[model samples]
Target: MRVKKLLLTLLLAFAALGSVALAEEHKATPAHETAASEEAAYESKSLWKMMTSFYDTTGLKAIIEPQDGVKNGLGQDMSKFSQSWGRVIMFAIIFFLFYLAIARGFEPLLLLPIAFGGLLANIPIANMTGEHGMLGIIYNMGISNEFFPLLIFMGVGAMTDFGPLLSRPKTALLGGAAQFGIFGSLVGAAMLSQYSGFVDFSLKQCSAISIIGGADGPTSIFIASALAPELLGAIAVAAYSYMALVPVIQPPIMKALTTVEERRIVMKTARKVHKLEKLVFPLLVIMMTALVLPDAAPLIGAFALGNFAKESGVVDRLSNEMQNSLINIVTIFLGLGVGSKLAAEQFLVAETMGIMIIGLLAFAAGTAAGVLMAKLMNKFSDEPINPLIGAAGVSAVPMAARVASKVGSEARPGNILLMHAMGPNVAGVIGSAVAAGVLLSIFK
Candidate 1:
């Protein structure tokens, strides 16, 4: 009987606790629902405003009329129409680049990201490449500091084998000769500025544009960032676009410059290059170039360090990381950062047209000089060089070299000149950097 009484008392207490719990939940539910509704209303209003921003001046009014409620604003606002049209035009340009990258397979790795970033940058009302934006942060972090291109050069050095140039150091002359194109274009740029009112391109801007002739994208970007940050985008695009078109551009030029008989000439086998020579080459180049042109030290030093780490045999991990993981990472950012500079206001001007013209002239001049220099070298050297290989000195790296080899092979069924062309090919990299240093010094 006592137990039963105790159990009933316990049940009554539990029932009372359950009633209080239910009452509290019931009281809190209305407040929770009200808070959720308020958040939803706020989100819907914000979304409406965002949607209306796109049609701000497009003569589309009914879509946003209900939300705006205010009737004072015009149905068609043309205040910022030019900028809006500029964005539209930029989007079209980026899409065309996308087609080139994806559909046509033109330097897809870099071009694709560049196109995407351009797309992001020109998106009206998003401010995707504005200050503190994702692309802006990326650009300021590496490109503005002029650091990423040097990093890319380091990666390029790590992957490059200097054996071809080392075996036949004379071919380095072809590389040196090709740099005349850069200076030639400088003169052309100056003339354009002096004669044409289209652009008053300063010597600095001319230097940046002329570097495009080197056909070295990283070197081009590095020089442009330092000298003419304003023209970097147009110059980079022209440089890379021309580089991608090398096979088409070079073959015709090579064929035009070299006789059929000269193209058929076979090169002797390259002498065996010792590992010690390979290891010391980068150091020697850095010390020599840096001493002569301190301005080039940053780029040359970084390149030499990368090559040293690669050839030293003790720093395999560092070399691997630089060539593979690190370069890939930087390439993405570099592409995007460069693309950010292609905002419509910057690209639509007559100055960009001038840059494009100057860049083309620079490349053509470089190619012609390289070919002519090779012919001159042939007159002096008993070891007869295939003049076609001289065109590889423009520093498009393996692409220009391959074009030389391909042209040679077409002339002579079994003739192989790829390795021979590579001698001048790698030398062109050093030559271009030196040219950039010279220009930097002159203008400074």
Candidate 2:
């Protein structure tokens, strides 16, 4: 009986071993089969699938593919161009920008290229703005590297005359005062983020948006690129649009702030600025700014170099090239490059509307601050300054200055505040650069 029991136990042990081996085989077979299938699928991928999947969802194929299955038909390919609300709205925005450029002549040079680039960007399947595409190349070369803004600044510096600003050093204060808008807009942005919970703008994004208060497009672009690259298109569009509308925007604010008597108040002629002053000014500014705020060195440095070339009177050829040829070329590329960010996916966001609204407020605040500061100065000083010139301190360059002069002349015919307004106008540029530097230092 004991022998019989031993034989039965041996049989049971062998049967258990066979069951375990069968289970192991079952597990290994599925894994091997899955590996082989995966390899086959990867190898069998169609050219269209391979091409569309190259960059993942960023490619046209990935976006247009149906939820159920891969359809490489023409209809599916063209669907993104028409089916998406973002793309459709972007088309409207692009057309509106074109109308503004061609019909109203609002920033025609920049707007035209921007509109054209936007048009190119919206076309489906072309992938004009993909990694290796033309718009992408332009963006990576100029906007991504932050070279275009500096180039624009160089050209602006070469063309700029600091004589007016140098002659009236005190007017630089207005420029400094106008920067209140930037900081004020910061408060507004933070408040919006805190209270609304609708758009969560970080400190960096707020900084980029607030620079719009400077009313300087390149500065806005530079700050946006450094701090909030995603917001570049909306911030830039708002900055440039408000700048072009300076004629329309500033006049109402100017009339509302100053009395006719204040507007008509004419100041004495500015002292003649010597060439030595002009030559030394750019160098002095560069040295002082570099020593104080090295973070802003890129913008301040480029601007000073351009000014140096212009003022030194030694590099007229280089200066002329920077002011004209170099600037013009960069402007075309810069506009188009900036427009690349205006792609539907990027632009049609809640943050864009916030940027536009806040930008307008910042501009208004800057104008008010400059005017108020000038009024305060008038109370303390013997020199009579037309408070109207304070509005020119937003650094829209000649546009702000021209509006100041126009408004002043309108208040009192023959009262030319162009040259006087120019003092604060140019000063505003320096002030804006300084503000940008300050933000860079803090954030960077």
In candidate 2, which residue ranges exceed 4 Å CA deviation? 1-83
TM-score, prediction 2: 0.83
Error of 2 at 413 (Å): 0.7
Model 2 lowest lDDT segment of ten: 66-75
- Candidate 1's displacement at residue 281, Å, is 0.4
All candidates: CA RMSD (Å): 16.4, 18.5
Candidate 1 worst ten-residue window by lDDT: 69-78
**What TM-score does each of the candidates earn?**
0.83, 0.83
Provide the lDDT at 375 for model 1: 90
Cα lDDT of model 2 by residue, 88-204, tens digit = 467668877877787778888898888888877766456677777788889999898899999999989998999888888898888888998898998998898889888989999
lDDT of each: 0.82, 0.83
Candidate 1 regions off by >4 Å? 1-82
